[model samples]
Target chain A: MSSGEAGWEERSVARIVPPIRPRKLAKVPFVELAEGRLQGVVSSGSSATRVYVSSIEAETHDFNCSTNNNRPCGGAQGSFHCKHLKALIDEAVKQYGLERVARYLKVEAAEGDDLHSLLNGKLVKAPAAVVFSRFLRHLTYLKVPAGSEPLPEMHWFPALKAVH
Target chain B: MQGVQLAELVQTPPGVDEAMEAVAGFDAALADGLSRLGPRHSEAVDALAGAVSASPLGAAAADACGELAVGSISDTELSALAGARAALLGAVHDALLARLDGALGRTRAEWEEHPADAQEPPANLLAGARSWLRELAIAGWRGVDEELVSAADQTLEALWAEPRLRRLAVLLDGLAAELRVSCPVATMERIPERRWADLWTRAVLLAHSGSWTGGAAAVSGRLLPLGVDVHEHGTAVQAQLHAVLEPRGDGPVRLVRAAVAAAKVDTIVGPEVWDLLSGHPTLLAAIAERRAVDIADMPLTADGDLLWDEERAKAGEPADPFATARVRLPDAEAPAVAPLDRHPVRIAEPVLVEGYKAKRDGTFDLGGAAIDVDADRLPPSGPLTPQLVNASTACIGLLRWDAGRWTLQPLAVRSVAKKQPVEAHNGDWALGPTDPKAAKALARSGSAVAVLTERAGKLLRK
Candidate 1:
């Protein structure tokens, strides 16, 4: 670290939570902070077409892990997190960094508290239908070919008034 | 094309052909989109309108030249002088540049997509263009000979007919069109310096003409590494490393480019480019990889580009660029707002902008004004990483007006000054031997490029 990095960390970051650890690569392919939740799809280790839709709710730390078809995971039981649910958290940390994920989840993290340490007791089961449907809809975008022709769906995204 | 609403450019990302399509019906679009753009920037359009739409000045120049003709002049002959004066007026230059940008980018993308078609410049065609230029140069003020003009036109027309060659052929044909005008020549210069230089820069870039050394000067600075580059001139493939520097003495901020050319017949953008660099000097490797260096006195261009002369320029010390008191970002000047021409330029204003915010869209959210970037044209490189919006507070770059908003092609970026600032780029790579493997990949190189440099060339010449 250069001499000013310590001070830069202080200035560039808001002190809402302890500075997050440097994030690593995604443990799973997809993760995002949308629908007021840290949620995305994770591929199944043993199955090819099979994907587990996982999410941790923003407000309640309510967690859900199930096959896209609603079959519940064997690992996500009681207070323990399955690998898919943990992968979702890991990827969220990678995407938004540790501090943002902690802040968004309303985790009270102190200095040197890794993500898992901060979110120790804040999880419970939640319905997975909304997230799974959203994931299915999200997969539809992958087929959207690159082009400039006004898209039918995009037409509803009101044209912003021209910048003067 | 009319200058877009700056906000519109920022808010609307192009859908591939958005800018091109909009520019196609530029005049009508301008009338509908923006009634009035900057009058100063309209010089090209106005001049072009005058040139094509029967200009009184062009008529006068034509009439003056028409009388001096030793024989009868054709309609084609008369229009040549007039059109050159009125300009395409800048449209030819703009269209040529845009096409070149698109073509090269497309070719590169295509190669990335389908590596099978990274075809070498069809040598004979390039040779034809080269011969046409040489013939034009030989003809000089006396005006190009008719036979040569006829032959070159045949070749140029064929070049134009080919879709792949269209972009590269634009400048060649443009120069041919300028050279072959049937109007009688006098001792006076025909084209303006701006047009001449503009054509020259694009032409050299297009042709990849090999090696031209600039006048040398004793220069020194706390060289902040900016970008790495590579280009293939006809005879040689050159690798260049660029840096922005603060002079050792009291002077304005300047840029330094260190370049080396290898006599190679292979394509510069080939698979084994690094292997070729492997045997070159340490500095060439450093050029291949943008590296920060601290130097006392080095032989460089008046603009501060390090010369190829090994005995003159000392190999600089490897150091971290961000370990500094401050980072300077010269306020880049935008040409009069012209929609047709992006008029991209490296920054010029002596200004330090700190505490600005970077956005996910590759723009620095400088309060009300935001500078946008196109991942296609200028991907955030060096210290301006993929996470620039999250990482750095300040960005250094080439500035241009695209669509409507002022855009920046980022060169370098760094954290804040209040702390141990971290730059996305530094000179740590130069500590190793000159084996070329140390050079960061995706680096750019050039030949006969010193004449076409952005920030440094402009500053020193002034």
Candidate 2:
């Protein structure tokens, strides 16, 4: 498992495409992916978001909108893509390496009429390094603010040493 | 010249000529007796009426006799005169027959010359009078012909009771209405009583035989209104009425058959037509049998509602597993309603039990019922194991009725959780651990062993 993680690091040298930043991956608190099984992105912060996936058919993507918002969705009305879906794809690339991520995203291109031709270039050019860096950043605990005061040390009593 | 010499030699009184003179004399006597009748003339008037009905030529003379009988004709002298009048009337009837024979001969001669014109359609002709000439040429007179029997019988009675020219005219009018023709009133009045009776009987029989075809039945539809006693005619007439509905026929007959099959016979009749259908029990039973067979072939549910039975769920078998027929209830002593499909309720404990069906589609069969397990309704651990061909554990779910079968909608699947048993020592003995081996070792030692429920702690001590 550790070697597989190293392999993902080795392949993540390319740059991320425009409009989607590595910082956005930090904003996504959690991601889960399984081949032909499950794909999800979850965040428990102020801006709550989730994307549950099973099949990657066009009709199945329409269901994702119904699951979250009780409406049909085809990325119409200038809503070109789902943010959570992108987050899930990026996190899968970070965890599973470029080869698995390319296969997973292959479904998106095959099912979407406009995306298939465009996604080939994006998949080949996407930087796995940026995906890993953003994923690792979220795993670290929250840091204390630099201006916070330090705690005072406690003094031990000398009489207790002999009693032991 | 030979014909003229024969005619000159025949100077003696001819029989027909003499009979005509006698008829004239009887008419004069009947008028005289009627004008001066006393109580003694009753028997003679009755005798005269009977005699007039019996003889073909005396029919006209019988008219006056009937009128005198209704009048105040009386006295022994008048009675003697009535007998004389009746004898004269009989002679007149013979003369009338001779006159009819002569007319028929003349008509045949006319037909021989212009055959088609002689037998023209009898528009506005009397039913009894239109074919008088032709009938005379063929049969001579009315009584000898088999076809004239019923007409002769009925006409004799009708003329006897009301022997007047006007009354005879009315009866001929009735016959003409049925025949749809007009006749000269004089010819109708002269028609023998037998011919009138025969016409009525023929019309009725023709109507009765029209059971198979709707055409004649439509014309015969008026029989019930005419006071015809059809039921008395036996099975032949009743069969015609009963089978008004045809089995293989089309149009009106088919429609009538469908209606009769669906309705009870008693409900189909009105009070007006009851007399025509009253005496036939066999006909009703036959109709009921036909109805049962027809209903059996219809696509119907056990409750008698028509439906298509499609076995969509049970492979090639029927979706309904229960018998759909009505069963007799022993306790109630009546027929029970059709039974519905039912299944045994599943009692699955939380513990994993074998013998339940599980599938990868997240479905199972419990107690012979198909069940769907919803992901949301399942426990957080989901299924602890992949579906086993021979399942040893089960989870209880709700039993639902759907499409004539019971289905189970699973709420949760029982999971397998391993339990760890702890062992502790009590003095020299190993105690109350669920380990069977430790307990067995102590048993083999033959030394007294104490079992502690918890870590060898002191009991009842401060």
Candidate 3:
């Protein structure tokens, strides 16, 4: 597309799009745990997108996103965002490549969760690229002690990188 | 009787016997003077003139002769004699009058000076007057006239002239009569009769010995006549009787022994032995033994049942009614999640993008936007996660978002590729290693190429 057309098309794309779903590949991996009486599942999609698993004992979490269809999505019924959703998204990105993880990093993914929604779709811009460049420099320079657990999943790092 | 006789003696007639007794002794002195008579007179005549001057008859004759002598004289001779006599008599009378006047004046002066001593009867004069009046009043002397009363009044007045004498006479008279008794000694006798009687009564009361008889009689009337004196006998008698009659201390112990003895008596003989046991000893033993019997032998009625019911009712009283039950909570476990990395995240000093501008010349611009990173600017010690990244970046990032309207994300880079001249250009753009070479080549040819670096692209997509 022409540059002007591209900008116009991006604005239109932003308005019309609902959230993209993670594409199915070969197999999805998952972990099981319990909180109170409810059991939870932490899983990775075929594209290494993270998803959460839960079943109702009394009430369900709003950000639960788990389904019998094996395709992770949103809409559940609890007051607060669920930890299962967070675990699913974080594990998906860490295990898979960033390009394959884009579908899960959509604006809607970070909407209920506090972190990754900050980036949204601003990655195509030059200024956003520069900011991402700076953030990469920061990540490369970051020193983590050996044998330590990885950092807890949060959305703001990439979002801040997009803004620079 | 003597008081009556004395009263009679005082009332006896006063006559010439008093006058004759008054002249009798002076007649003997007159006769002796006549024996020593003057020479010109006959002895008989001298004796007769002296006798006339001294005897009772002679005293009367002398009065007549003195009148004759005055009568026979001539007027001038009598006048001269009378004048001389009158002058002599006047001189003697004047001297005597002066003496009497001095004494009477002294007496009156003392009377006036101590008027109470003079006017009022001395305490002693009152005592004497009280005695005399008491005696006269006791006697039948109803009509003593004012003259006699005046004489008695004058006598009391003279006696009362000296206070000491008046007091002494009062004290003496008081002693003489039992009507008003004096104290043990005279000076202390001045207490009034009422006060004296009170003192005497008090002294008698304090003696105490006389009232003991009456007190004993009163006590004896109440207690001694009763038969309770049997308990007052010696302790040995009580002990001996107690040993023979009731040998043990407790009622049940004595009752059991008496029951055993009674059983033995009944066992030895039949109804005849029981009849022999009908006297006082048997009655008292039976009474004493009755106390040892258990209540099981007694008949029960509604009254007994009520008493027992009351005791049982008291024992089963209900416990406190307002007690509260305790509530127990079920155990709950915390959700299991992956633990956060304990390693702290360190952010270095940020590159100053504004002040170090890309210039055509070698010099850097100091006025452009600057970035400063301080490690101290990090939030206080707590969970360090990627969430803190934006919070820290926003502190230094001069950016704004239109809240609730547009979610615009601003980039931190500025385009400086155009400002670079061809002579100095080693590469067309300053994009880092993650950028594709084709884009770099395109940018070197003065074309706008979108540069994508692997790390930068990954962060953007996330």
Candidate 4:
């Protein structure tokens, strides 16, 4: 039990003993480059380690990733890049440790590429900019609030949309 | 020359004179036959014309003549008659005209003054008069008005009746009026009494058959006015009346009873009552077996009230003995040491015992030796042992051992047992196991022989 506690301490060591100067960026207002719409507010509380891109015009494609390219071009087959993904990554890095955020982003990027490829030609084709625009409008009408920042980015978003 | 003379005589026969004379003779015979047959033919023509003019046959003949004139009559006889009447009337007119110098007016006037009456009656006198004329006019008539005669005939037949039927009609009209006033409908028509009776009877029958609502009440109420006592007479009368009125089938006694039972009335009538009465013979049986009877009122005597008061006063008197006190004995307790020689202890009354124990202070343990005796039969000892002193008492004698021997003592006694030789035995033994050793010892002592015999008998039976 002592060793297990020590191991937990080691894994959470950075969180308990935060770095003297944690990487951070200034809080920025989220904006869709194409639509010039004020989408939401973004803060660099803990998710400054990774880059995140969000779009009010293209909700389905908006995403957070290690790289600036939201699309998983190399291997992102069935990826769901959305404002929620961006918000979650930002949340996870801010609330939890950056190491977990980085690890989470990498795994999510690989899984997203695989899913994108698998469902490329199916009825549930990845929503490109055009479909994303429609989805964004729908979400805007529904008024779905922004998700928590620094979310666990390693969690895979299922390709299945709303069943109904 | 002689031949000439004979020829001259024959020559004279071939002259115009001889031919003229022969023609004149033949004309005269023809005229005579014509005169005779012409009058008879004229008479026949006159007779036929009169018949045709005066009777339906005359009209027919006239019509036949007109039809013949227009080439419509094809019958030979009718055609001949028409031709003959035409000729006769024409001849008569012509003759009259000749006599009146061809003045048609004068001739018509003379005929009108003395109109021709044939020797025989018209051929269709009965058929040709007003009846036939009317028939002719009606034959050509059209429209529903043509049925007026037939309609009138039907109306008359429908309205016709015997005196009894008329009376019935009157009664029915009156009854219908009454019914209308009593139980009116929207539309009122004076229905005959027989019809009303029939309707009422039918309604009642339907009610009996369970066809109408409140039919039983309606029937009974209606029947009551007719002097029918449904409840008293039973359903039989109602049923018979129903059969008399409507003769359809048996009255619905069952339905009526069910209805009456539903109504839960003291008295019911009509079919419902009949139904109940007929179905439940138990009702009649209960009535027959009714046993409750009312007591008659007591008659008042001159001194009845006074006597009753005196009796009551005597009963209210107080009893002679005011109060009573009962003294109970204490129960017997076992002694620590059994008496060497059993001395019979007599208990005059029941008692309650406390407990048994020896006393202190060098004195004998009298707790177990205290004995209570009757005050009247107090022993010489001062107090009785505790074993004898079964329970507490206000007045009693107590005995105790001064040295170590059993003694007798007396206690206060409210009463004592009337019998002598009061038996004393160990209450424990009396209530506990029947030991044969004790029994033999008792038998040897020759005490309680009856108890021993009973115990022996009980052991034998076991």
- For candidate 3, the lDDT comes to 0.22
Model 2, global lDDT: 0.25
What does candidate 4's lDDT look like per residue over B342-383, in tens digits? 111111111122222223321222232333221212111112
How accurate locally is residue B460 in candidate 2, as Cα lDDT from 0 to 100? Answer: 14
lDDT of 2 by residue, B67-144 (tens): 555652322223333334434423433333233223222111110111111222222222333233123222322222
Off by over 4 Å in 3: A1-26, A29-158, A162-164, B1-370, B373-412, B415-462
The docking category that best describes candidate 1 is: incorrect
lDDT string, candidate 1, B323-350, tens digits: 3213432221111212211222211111
Task: Give lDDT for model 4.
Answer: 0.22
Q: Residue B167 in model 4: shift from native, Å?
A: 99
- Compared to the true structure, candidate 4 yields what TM-score? 0.10
True contacts kept of each: 0.00, 0.00, 0.02, 0.00
Clashes of each: 15, 25, 7, 60
Best by lDDT: 1
- The DockQ scores of all candidates, in the order shown, are 0.01, 0.00, 0.01, 0.00
Pick the winner on lDDT between candidates 1 and 3.
Answer: 1
Supply candidate 4's per-residue lDDT for A109: 32
What is the TM-score (0 to 1) of candidate 3? 0.12
